[model samples]
Target: MQEAAHTGVSEKSTIAPRKVLRHSVRGQILDALRAALVDGELAPGEIYSGPALGERFGVSATPVREAMQQLALEGAVECLPNRGFRVLTRTPRALAELAEVRALLEVPVMLRLARTLPASVWDSLRPAAAATADAAVVGDLPGYADADRAFHRAVLSLAGNEQLLQVAEDLHRRSQWPLPGAPRVRRADLVADAAEHVALLEALVAGDLAVVESLVREHFAGAAV
Candidate 1:
């Protein structure tokens, strides 16, 4: 009976680790899929098979399918029965709408922060702001996306509202999605956007609310376009 008990305990221990490993693999695959989507490697409106993606990633199809399901839930893809996941074609109008909503949600908060947060606070954000510019210079879409979001999160976190930060981040991600049948994002565009980050930071540091508001509105308008 003791031997049986020991065997059962070992089995339970093994099961939990296996579950964790699967979850880890799924998370890794999901991140890769998101990177692919942002990089324009997975073209919009193109259907990608789990088996094929698995081959590319050197894994089995199960994790790829799981990751694709998550993307589907995020409205990034659509599942086709007996087929695979199709990357959704994002329209400019959809992007504009998302940008409009994001501006509404974030501009007021940013303006408030500009009024309240001191120069030291804005100065402290320079490194994160610079990271976005660095990534943009190299045309690293995935790097830029991560850095851009991180910079925004750093600025917004000053408001101390976790819920608002999360919502704004989601909107920001949606805005960055590659448009249908479009080539990769222009290096010029990324540079221009990255410049706005620097401009906004400077405006905030100088306590110039008018410049801040203008920059913020122009930033979102550029994002929408």
Candidate 2:
């Protein structure tokens, strides 16, 4: 029952979904851990035991361990054989490299799609863009992250390259994890970033390739989760 885990568990509201789904306990815990990572609840370099987290979440240590293993696969945590799991520290250089890679993979595809995809396709993503904005207004980092990814996924799916889309998404998720010594994320920052989705969609629908390209690059430049 370390204080850090208690603090993380107390702020679990940031990770809780509005509506409960049919996810298994392990699946649910996995989502919760990811959200916690995004919100900086899981402090970098801190080791948390599965049994302790399981006790807090009211489940067996087995489920928590399973979830932690999944996170380890995602590079979010490292397993400590005789202890627990340690959240990995992400450096500025690493984060910047990820953003650059995302731009490299997504920008060209999105720019090309802007020219050919019908306005209707862009219009369909409006709801997701709006959802991100709404989540930001309430400082719901986890919700904003989910909505943001959904919007990007919708746009990239148009390229009909499932593998590319999946790889970009994995990078995007890692980008959202809070960096050590980073200032607490502000509501204004979230709102501005969320608005980029709307702006990008507008540019796509209006057939403004230059604006779309600029917006896409700008989006990655500030892709600060």
Give all TM-scores, in the order shown.
0.86, 0.90
Candidate 1: regions farther than 4 A off = 1-23
How high a TM-score does candidate 2 get? 0.90
Candidate 2: segments with Cα more than 4 A from true spot: 1-23
Q: What is the model-wide C-alpha lDDT for candidate 1?
A: 0.81
Candidate 2, residue 41: CA error in Å? 0.8
- Superposing every Cα of model 1 onto the true structure, what RMSD results? 10.7
Candidate number with greatest TM-score: 2
lDDT of 1 at 125: 98
In lDDT terms, which candidate is top? 2
Q: Write the per-residue lDDT of candidate 2 for residues 1-225, one digit (tens) a residue.
A: 445554442323222332324459889889888877888778887777787677667777898899999999999999987578889999989999999999999999988888888988898889989999999999988888898888888888889998998898999999888888788789999999998999988988888989999999999999649
